[model samples]
Target: MKKYVMAGAISSILSYQACVLAQENQSKSDFSKQSYFLDGFSRNNLDQEKVALSTHASRLVVQLATDYQQGMAIDWADYLFSEKLDGIRAIWTGDRLITRQGTPISAPSWFTDDLPDYAVEGELWAGRNRFEHVMSVVMDDKPDDMEWGSIRYMLFDLPNQPHDFVTRFDALVRFVDQTAAEHIQYVAHFPALSESHVQSLLTKVDQNGGEGLMLRKMTGGYDLGRSDNVLKLKLAIDAEALVIGHVEGKGKHEGRMGSIVVKTDDGKVFKIGTGFTDKQRGTPPEIGSLVTYRYNGYTKNGIPKFARYVRIDKSKQ
Candidate 1:
């Protein structure tokens, strides 16, 4: 039995290695034949242009989080929870700041002059419920100096560092304190004790107009993409759907607009009418565009319950 088990394990390892090599070879072949042009510009040329506009911002990528579900398999004691700042994700590559997609933010030199010469990852926050304002400032080709003044770099993790999260967090706090850079600050985190505590914190944050909570595993290393090490906890979940059509307005909504017909990622169709402002109704998300909607949970039929329009998914454009 022992001999058989050993042979099976070795066979499985060899099979996995063969599969990986096959995938890598296929990827290289595809890349060689792939058209360089996408969206009117050569892919290579676009990448080169992005590199030219950025200074040492090409290599950095921020870590992402997965949504937290009830009864998820995570050790709560090993997690630290913090307020999920609804701001633009930025990576400070020691010298300059860049978005997760490697687009260089046109921040003034003074904004980063006092920052340390170490790679840091965090959000470019404006304040509570100021996501639109923050986006307007950072997404511009030429950042407005006055608007940038209100922005803060809320550092959360130090990428590629050898230290664990707690140690890295402490180092970040000390570094920020020594630099005395008002805009460069660390995000405050607390121990996640129990489910009740998590719920209480979520309620408090929501009541204060905050977005949600982020839970990070204390012992996990800084990972590049979405990982189980970090989780996003929210009271109401939001998801993107493709707008297919529109349901005409009625009563108070007459003469303006009505609910939007959308198809969810899983192919479930629904109409979302509530949570739209008058201006948004006047200029509803166009048919065939993508939009985000908020929901408490899914119904028995697998449809999103209490679905309401959140915002147009500008990222899709």
Candidate 2:
């Protein structure tokens, strides 16, 4: 099946926030009890040694506007723009394919029967608006024949090329066109000659239930860590994460007010304390399951500064 990639930014705030609430009241002793998604995969050819990603990765976050004002700004429009589909992110590296959190998707042999031996990144989606159910099957690795039948592996970028976003995206579109497979369809990248064009697309995507759009630099090199060049914009929502440590509290809650520690799938730790209600603190999330939190900014020490609990993420981990 041919697959096309849509362009837009992915934000970590929601993901990060979820991790925070997940870790609340949990102690380091519980880390071993957790089933980290990465633990289930085969290590053989797993690219154990991490490579520095390109300077400008495909993770750019796209900014949106309510109304387009001509002659505003453009960040190298070479990147393609597409509706950010809500699906599980997967990275297929030759032998094995895994989710962003490193869970092994038990896709039926038939599901991946047409895949080539290439390093591809895309979403493991079942059907439109079935995100929660789709994630449940893929993350479980249970090899459900009936479940796999409804799924599609929507690939967007090939990792081996070592090209910038623009170059890789162009190649992705061409490859999908050539394959002409029904199961695979290219993620559309709409071109906007003016700001109004961008506004129209954003409105269309949001109304259609998409997360948002990603903006990428065509000529920029891919970077291993997060890059500012790629930004994400979206409506406010809470998320969950793992708690790592605590901070000193202030004011009435001062003695107990420090912040809470949280970690992302990427292993970046931050703090949360500003968004939770008093009731949430009484029954914080367990050490393992996902939880939600909120806050902004990082400290000079590279940790989250202010954050508070929101709720538990009942979604499958």
The local distance difference test score of each candidate is 0.69, 0.50
| Candidate 2: segments with Cα more than 4 A from true spot | 1-76, 178-181, 194-196, 237-239, 242-287, 292-317
Looking at model 1, the pairs that clash are 36-43
Tens-digit lDDT string for candidate 2 (51-96): 3223224332221223212343655344334445567767665566
Best by lDDT: 1
The TM-score between candidate 2 and the true structure equals 0.55
* Candidate 2 overall lDDT versus native: 0.50
* Poorest 10 consecutive residues by lDDT, candidate 1: 1-10
Distance (Å) between predicted and true CA of 166, model 2? 3.1
lDDT of 1 by residue, 187-268 (tens): 7555676767787767766776777888888778776667888899999998999999888798999987798999977899
Residue 69, candidate 1: C-alpha displacement in angstroms: 2.0
Error of 1 at 310 (Å): 2.2
